[model samples]
Target chain A: MSTVEHTDRGPLSREEMAAVVARDIPDGSYVNLGIGQPTTVAAHLRPGSGVVLHTENGMLGMGPVVTGDDADPDLTNAGKQPVSELPGASYFHHADSFAMMRGGHLDVCVLGAYQVSASGDLANWHTGAPDAIPAVGGAMDLATGAKDVLVMMTLFAKDGSPKLVPACTYPLTGVGCVSRVYTEVALFDVSGDDVVVLETWGESVAELVDRLQLRIARATRPRGPGRLR
Target chain B: MSRTQFHTAAGGTTAAEAADAALSASGVASGMTVLVGGFGMAGMPVALVDALIRHGADELTVVSNNAGNGDTGLAALLAAGRVRKVICSFPRQSDSWVFDGLYRAGRLELEVVPQGTLAERMRAAGAGIGGFFCPTGAGTLLAEGKETRVIDGREHVLEMPLRGDVALIGAHRADRAGNLVYRKTARNFGPVMATAAATTVVQVGGVVEVGALDPEAVVTPAIYVDHVVDLRSTSGEEHAA
Candidate 1:
């Protein structure tokens, strides 16, 4: 058996995309990182940044991942993955943890999305497949509760279809909740019905705008991958 | 069914039989709503849940954080076809074949709620709050037909409190008076669910003396807990083992 190799146009890696998102979180901010790709954001936060990490599974000030004997089976994140706790970490009931979220106490939430409408709607929890069991979890709560919602995903699907669309076809998690999107290929900020290109990877901004037929507002020219280095 | 074996609450402590007796006496009727506590397998009241399943209640509406994982625990209850609808946050995970099969076959119904909202609704029910405003599902289908309000310049949606006929929960320890203390994250929904149900039965790892537990450490005070089962006893060990 042989594995096929392929190449695509992109500069920032997934880690770089996470770093790009992490750089925007201000000091003293309370943030929630959604499961899956968004969990990577914690590894890239600058030291002593003072960003408090909140997990929907009733924990605040969560530390990095714990492995081997150090892992506590009961001490886990919303994803049920074992994790450590930083100093001053506190635990609460599930209801109280949500009270923090729905009360708008979180400054930012970075999430993984399946589709994001140009108008900032999110469709990440379900694909509407007939056989698929939808897991909505805390996505809807984070979508609406966080002051600023940043979505992290690839620019397109594995099938080469654009995830950024005129309107989300899947069942939406929340409407007009997403403010910024960090993709493998580009960074865009979503307004009411327009997408502003903040940066593009290897692909030219004009090319992406033309290919996707995006109504683009270019705030600045695309930078090379070496710029981050 | 076994009225002779049942005993009502006197003081804070009820008969141990109440855990099973209350549920059994509730008649195991169809279309009943039950609140169960656990996140994965962390803090589930296994003995109480097993008793409920053995009682063979059908057409139940179970509210929990996750649909049972693997083939044991809540999954066993679900596999027995005792549930009609499940109100949960994450209804499906890698090992949730029972719910998936039943749902796909149209034998089951699901109401998927966000985790925070689910917790808050139960909290509201227990705290005696009529209803509260939340922004969690405001612009989504979950917000459809629900009242909307603008608070602090942001759109918020109304979510009503949720209550259950019975609550099955777990705790690390409990006093003779039923003051409950939980171990770490296992305490997920137990405290809130204890307050939201008409009859709350707790399965504790151990049952200590009346003054054994520290008052400050008690998460669910004796006032909220109706019945207690000590799962750490030799009999409980045999049942679980």
Candidate 2:
């Protein structure tokens, strides 16, 4: 596979990046979207896909985020934000909810990350900064328990430093758990023997390889009908 | 005292008197591990916590998912300076100023557990299991102080039981016999906390006849529940529109 080119398009919007992630999810996959940006993927899910959403707090078949009277305090997502339920929604206690996450029952879980290692280690919980109050929530559980852990984040930090590196500088959330890295700039395949470049936005494979400073291998598997051209 | 106390306490005439009777019988003394239920305010037992605050128990160790939300349920308790330590997963949220201030000032002790491990530890406690090896938090900073084991060639961390002195939970409805039914996603920590506590107390929207709740759909069975405060009439203002 070679670099994906969308010459007609400008920079990817937030919705477009979410649409990219949504395109990869196979039909009838059981997915769990983490809080913040990854939660936006639920908005792009194709209807009748039979993709049940699992929230760590306690819910399956969660509906899209709602407002006004539709927002019930009683029905909320993992983030503790108000949400409604779909037709087949079900609720459980925290233990069982996390059991679904930690038991490898979920097909895929998309999470936001601070940094991800080339060897598939994830670091999203705490930065290990002495002053930062540590909060892990279900990050470790989702990272460990999902069948395939997919991280959604920007490719670089604000300082223009790469987040996808040889090893994570931050504290780890999971070791060798991530399968893919979905970034604003490109999509990476970290599950296999090689760190394959699945797709890229405006940059070439050489550009990413030079910037990331990690070993890059050509695609070992054939490409699918990707969202980009 | 006992689960039977709910039935025999003052003949259980009205909801208020019954709620008062349930709170008084909670045995919420000072220096106890209190497991408060809810994810944010979804299934928060506001009335029970309010009663506990009125019960005047100090130096409590609370086990919950979040430290507290706004200055209400658990936050109010923290703000009252009654809590000595907090064992929760996430304590820093937008409205968690009370916990933030306390944590920064070194007035409170905190143990940040992973959410899944937090729940499973209580589940293990309730199930009478000592501890189990878990895959969550295996290689993280959270697992540093804990014991580690390898099962199936993958690293796992040992998680121990976390039973409570008393559990405060919110449910949608309950039978007079205390078999509870929770509403929607509000059933977050109610079921596990109910079983993990030495004395489990619940606050439900209504108290139905013993046969009103479907036996098949009851989440927390009556045997695990010790007392249920029927907040049907009194909890309207607490859960406003």
Q: Which is the leading candidate under TM-score?
A: 2
lDDT of each: 0.80, 0.84
For residues A1-229, could you state the per-residue lDDT of candidate 2 as single tens digits? Answer: 5646444545468888888889888778889999999999988888877889988888888888889977888888888788878888888888998888888889999999999888899999898888899898889889999998888899989999999988999999999999888887778877766677777777666767888878976554374325321
Compute the DockQ of candidate 1. Answer: 0.62
Would you give me the overall lDDT of model 1?
A: 0.80
Predicted chain B of candidate 1, TM-score versus the true chain B? 0.88
Chain A TM-scores of each predicted structure, in the order given, are: 0.90, 0.93
By summed lDDT, which 10 consecutive residues of candidate 2 chain B come out lowest? B1-10
Regions of candidate 2 where Cα sits further than 4 Å from its true position: A1-10, A223-229, B1-4, B7-20, B234-241
After TM-score superposition, the amount by which residue B83's alpha carbon in candidate 1 deviates from its true location, in angstroms, is: 0.9
Q: Score the docking of each candidate (DockQ).
A: 0.62, 0.86
Question: What is the Cα-based lDDT of residue B147 in candidate 2?
Answer: 92
